[model samples]
Target: MSSLKLKRFIKDSFPDNNLIIVSNREPYLHNKSGSNIKVEMPAGGLTSAMDEALRSTGGTWVAWGSGSEDKNNVDDNDRVAVPPGKPSYTLKR
Candidate 1:
């Protein structure tokens, strides 16, 4: 099972020599309530490292609002279907 998932991840990352990330967690987030807004901390370790690597390599990282409630839904703008706690990663065109 784990192997399959890894394979899929690899495919998504290097599909046609493109590196993209589609996840339910964004690197950064902003929380808004009424007139007050707050910024949340980003993911740690692996997530942060991945973000850095992508940036250095000119890859892509697709994540949720990093704290948005609608992250589980498929965004109309990107047409990406993300789960409640998991996101999809694909190569950017």
Candidate 2:
């Protein structure tokens, strides 16, 4: 669905409630390739499917922080807003 429609649906269906998605793997991964931090996309459709839905709702995704550099990205609260440059949701690793 388009983001507009998704947003409207979320706004109507879950008003005053927080939207959260918990998964075994994170949508994005961070690793140290030599000295540079590289962000890697998972090798499946799950990320693509859930990303927009979460983004539309501005939800929180609780997933395993399996990446090597995962700790370096989160705040003191251990939450990282995801999709990097155009962040729209919180990721609690």
Clash number for every model? 5, 0
Candidate 2 lDDT at 61 equals 92
lDDT of 2 by residue, 1-93 (tens): 798898899889989987888999998899999999998878878778788888888889999999999999999988998888999999999
Candidate 1: worst-modelled 10 consecutive residues by lDDT: 84-93
Kindly give the stretch of ten consecutive residues in candidate 2 with the minimal lDDT sum: 40-49
Candidate achieving the largest lDDT: 2
- Candidate 2's displacement at residue 83, Å, is 1.1
Residues 1-93, candidate 1, lDDT per residue (tens digit)?
Answer: 254565566567777765666766665454565665544546587666565445344445666454453243335563332211443442221
- Against the hidden reference, what TM-scores do the models get? 0.43, 0.90
Regions of model 1 farther than 4 Å from truth: 1-16, 33-39, 69-93
Query: What lDDT would each prediction earn against the true structure?
Result: 0.49, 0.89
